[model samples]
Target: MEKLCPRFEKAMGLISTRWVGLILFDLLKGTKRFSEMEADLPISGRLLSDRLKMLEKEGIVKRNIYSEFPVRIEYSLSDKGNELEPVIKAIQFWADEHIPPEETDDTDEQRV
Candidate 1:
């Protein structure tokens, strides 16, 4: 069998990181503020912040800061990140088919 390429390995490393796939999946809905994501996902604010920073650095996510009294910040997928939509959808489909409800936690059901 052919060895996995470095690019594939790197991509897996990023997406397989805890919460990274979920973060990307959530952003697929639309751009969201940090607090919005915090509320949407079970992740803590600090860990979410860290993952956002990492994704931003990887060019998978974009961070926009609005110049306002409160300095609002929002996150959206970069073009590259948007390209993963089909992949994310496939995963969701697979889970729905193969992963029984009883095997998944309550939170997992609500996320879909």
Candidate 2:
């Protein structure tokens, strides 16, 4: 096997975390409010918040706060995050081809 560069290892480490890929994939659809994302994904509010913060720190996600009656916050992919479109699609394609669908009746699987 070839040696892995530190930069590549760092990036892979960031993106490979649980829920990160799914989060990015959802954001690709368009900007989403915090509640909306929470509804769409089965992730806990705390975990989601932490992941969003991490992504923001990495410059992969942008969080926008709107001064409204209730204070609306939305999340969208940054340019760097958008660049992962091909990578996300490739993973989706590979999973579709190689992974068999689960026969579980749990509705959680439908979320992300």
Candidate 3:
């Protein structure tokens, strides 16, 4: 098929955003709560929540509730999500080696 199916579009759309790479990279580090993710990512609350929800729906992220008093929730990568690690790392490695400073508007905050 020439055109992308809605499911394909939806699935690819989940991790094909600006800050998604960073989000997934961080989630791979460990399970993190909503606030922790927000604090680590540069996107706004709405965008982060949207990304998290999309990933969860796509089976790339699994959310858990650990506390009720403060309503604590944590997000981690699912099995499928863990499967993306190598791809992400490969791409990141390529970018780290080739992409230079003054590139796109990605707020990596570190010089290669």
At residue 106, give the lDDT of candidate 2.
Answer: 46
In model 1, what is the error at residue 32, expressed in angstroms? 0.3
RMSD of each: 1.5, 2.0, 3.1
Error of 3 at 38 (Å): 0.7
**Candidate 2 off by > 4 Å:** 103-112
Residues 33-107, candidate 1, lDDT per residue (tens digit)? 998999989888999999999999999999999999889999999999999999999999999999987887876
Tell me the lDDT of model 2 at 39.
87
lDDT of each: 0.92, 0.89, 0.82
Q: Provide TM-scores for the models.
A: 0.93, 0.89, 0.80
Candidate 1 stretches with Cα past 4 Å from truth are 107-110
For TM-score, candidate 1 versus 3, the one ahead is: 1
Q: At residue 90, what lDDT does model 3 achieve?
A: 89
Which pairs clash (backbone N, Cα, C closer than 3 Å) in model 1?
A: none
Which candidate tops TM-score? Answer: 1
Estimate, for each residue in 11-110, the C-alpha lDDT of model 3 and write its tens digit: 5676677778888898889899899988887778998898888788879999998768888899999999999899888878998888875676655542
Residue-level error in angstroms, candidate 2, position 25: 0.8
Return the lDDT, model 1, position 21: 85
